[model samples]
Target: MSNNDFEKVIITIKVRGSNEEYDFEVDSKVTVEELLFKFNEFLSIHKSSVKENQRYIVMVETKHDFIDPTLTIEEAGLWEGSILILTPV
Candidate 1:
């Protein structure tokens, strides 16, 4: 198949304020916004009892490039092992 999406990718995420890092396995076709939403949901569930009304932007940790939330992981040129930083917008 020519599609690269549908496959799993391991993304390492670092929140802007905190030094703690998290790794997630997500579908390559998922949009950046969706991933952020999921990550936020995860945080709300594990760390706190209530969800925060916050928005985030994803960035390439090494390159310092801001990724568009509308773009899919593959479209963003993210590979199997990608490091990302989440910053509040």
Candidate 2:
């Protein structure tokens, strides 16, 4: 593993049909997909809730388009304070 430190970042979790806001610390090495897994664990959503092919998308900000959570922060070019909006498709 590279010694590059994954700068700490705050990720806000917003589940569909839920008005809850959960925050988590993530390293640049983490992927959005992994974050979803953590979110699933936190919300206690069954695996069946996570659909195939229609995976959730994480928006980096107001713009910048959407990105797959499966991609690491370095690959997705994410930075600290970058708001990751998790929305289910």
Candidate 3:
């Protein structure tokens, strides 16, 4: 794997309208689909209230734009300290 594949970025993820925030060190090359999967995994481990069927959309907090799940983190324009929001879709 290339260095980019293993590169990590710190991002803040939060559920919409909730003050609770999660900090994750994610592989910079991760696709949005993978990121959502990771988010779900995190929720399952930390916040059990999230149901299996609960769908989420990831958005760049500052830009307020939904990220394309087909794209990798670098392709999605994510960087260190970027803030993301996971809202129910």
TM-score for each predicted model, relative to the true structure: 0.86, 0.66, 0.85
Candidate 3 Cα errors over 4 Å, as ranges: 1-5
Clashes of 1: 0
Q: What are the lDDT figures for the candidates, one per model?
A: 0.83, 0.69, 0.84
Best-to-worst TM-score order: 1, 3, 2
User: For residues 1-89, could you state the per-residue lDDT of candidate 1 as single tens digits?
Assistant: 56653888988888888888888898989987788888888888888743495787788987899999899888998887798998776
Task: For candidate 1, list the clashing residue pairs, or say none.
Answer: none
lDDT of 3 at 20: 90
lDDT of 3 by residue, 1-89 (tens): 76545788987888897999888888888887887788888778878788875687889999999888899888999999988888887
Report the lDDT tens digits of candidate 2 across residue range 1-89: 56875677776766555576678788878887887777777555544655544456677655658786668876887676566666777
Off by over 4 Å in 1: 2-5, 49-51
User: How far is 49's C-alpha from truth in model 1 (Å)?
Assistant: 7.6
* Pairs in steric clash, model 3: none
Q: Is candidate 2 or candidate 3 better by lDDT?
A: 3
- In model 2, state the lDDT of residue 71: 89
Give lDDT for model 1: 0.83
